[model samples]
Target: MSKRLAQRADSRETEIAAVAADALEGRVPAGSLVCGDPDGVVEAALGGPVWNRYAYDGRPAQPWPPEGAFPGAVLRQPRGWGAFAMTLHALAARLPEGAPLWIYGGNDEGVTSIPKRLEGLFGEPETLAIKRRARVLELRRTGAPARGGLEDWREVVSVGDAELVSYPGLFAHGRLDPGTELLLGALPKIYADQSVLDFGCGAGVIAHTVRRRVPEGRLTLLDMDSVALHAARQNVPDAAHVLSDGWSAVPAKRDFDLILSNPPLHRGKEEDFGALEALVRGAKDRLKPRGALIAVVQRSAGVGKLFASVLKNVEALAETPQYQVWRGGV
Candidate 1:
């Protein structure tokens, strides 16, 4: 990894610690709301037994802002601009007038640009602290309740013959991505009764394609993001959905005849191969004896080596200047 990427990978905990320290030092008020806190770090730092929590991903927390009043809110900035904006809007709508909103994030995650987006709904933010290349800012809810409901952000896009419903912050939101289009075009024929799992399925595009090809086949869609999964549920209602981080929430007894994806490569602003690597390594245990795992990735991802390490009969199914499709069978 490059020096910057290495620092990004290593600095998450440190950045969270810095935010937590500020929260503990009286920046965050008691009975505050919180979101994007991995492992509840900020909540723990606040010395609270319980706090109103919201999560966009498949964490053990509320999917929407809780109904009630809060003295303030502490938000760990989300990766995508859409996710962050949605969360901010939701908080603004729910928080009482003058309630403090404490937002913090790494500089690389675009912490400094937050105030610009807050122009209408929040007062000018006060810079609380800047440490460990991370920053914390305090602002008060000012504008009238903004339209922050999930339906408010809904978008629909046409892909081939299908119209997919998606929200912002989702991969390739409102359109089909080139890598996925390549993967779809090059997909192998599916048997009518085969079981297929769309690993890291975003908005169920891959699973939807598989469904049209083999309507009788049992389909499963898995992803960590609740918002994307919500869109997937609308687009492909027949497929079983699993909100999980990797295979953590998937039942071990379940196995698939085929698994496919255009796997995610980035976590926040940094290139993260951990999820992709884990998916490749764990496919062996999740696939049936003759099942295969197929995926599309950037040409430079070096995914072929990982596929070869665990899966037998690995081969490149298709290739382009910018992307490659790989398939590996057990």
Candidate 2:
């Protein structure tokens, strides 16, 4: 398994593992929906595929699980508060009356107050278990979900004159990220007819800016996360949107003149740069000769070292206390 999958498997041995195991074995039921799957560990424990579907092609279609289609759902709390709130509301909105929704995570994963968060929608939640430094809570929907507060998590925002659609759980959902802003500010002038790929395009903010700045460039937005891509489509309607885990999923024959990214470095509360490293290591092969790869990465992320290990030359284009934009070409 990859590092991401390995970390998720390791989490299954924690305090709430036994309860989760038991719930997966019987209580959660087959055909129940699973949201925010953590490395397919939950799906494997459930013993088969469940009702897990993702929105496609940056479209808002099926953004939430269908209402009352399943008796219950199992959710792994996301690290972001916006993601957590959105997940909670989405689960509540879809679950049938009296059906249970279970949320599980460790204290270190930043999910200790989930029960409190669910109280308004589901009344007092039931503490299922607390062990091995982890906690599990169950809430049964008794009435329609209280959705009055969910609008905040689903609002679109204006970033540098671009009206970008954002949803909870997307990185920097409501606004532009500083790293992305820095990258946009420092983007080298694009020559005519260049093909640009926005790798890990979150909410299409970078793609939107690139298209505006380089109108002659053909833009393609790619991201592993369906929600991010969905948001991106709204921001850059004219650009192509590709759903991909990494370079592996991109078309083998396609090459780009410019590649851009604000590569993800975190999975929940855990920091893992393997994905970013993979992108850096494989980037040169995907670019045409004289083509460049540009990215905004955290200064402490060792991105310079990663780039230096793979590329002959890596140049720092712009810097802030929190981030830096780096560019390199074959």
lDDT of each: 0.79, 0.72
| Top-lDDT structure, candidate number | 1
- Taking the tens digit of each residue's C-alpha lDDT, what string does model 1 give over 35-129? 66755667667753233222323456434677777788888787778777878887887688899888888887798999888747889999878
Model 2 alpha-carbon miss at residue 29, Å:
2.7
Deviation from truth (RMSD, Å), model 1: 2.8
Cα misplacement distance, residue 40 of candidate 1 (Å):
3.1
Residue range with the least summed lDDT across 10 consecutive positions in model 1: 48-57
For model 1, the stretches where C-alpha displacement exceeds 4 angstroms are 1-10, 47-58
User: 1-330, model 2: which lDDT tens digit per residue?
Assistant: 235643654464333445565555666767777765545556567753343324322322234555555777887666677777676776777666788777778777766777666646665667777767677777788785545333445677777677778887777866778889899989888866888999999788888887777776789998877677777887788888877767656755438999999998765555667678877877878888888899999898857876787776789999999999998887
Error of 2 at 96 (Å): 1.5
At residue 38, candidate 2 shows an lDDT of 41
Any idea how many clashes model 2 has? Answer: 3
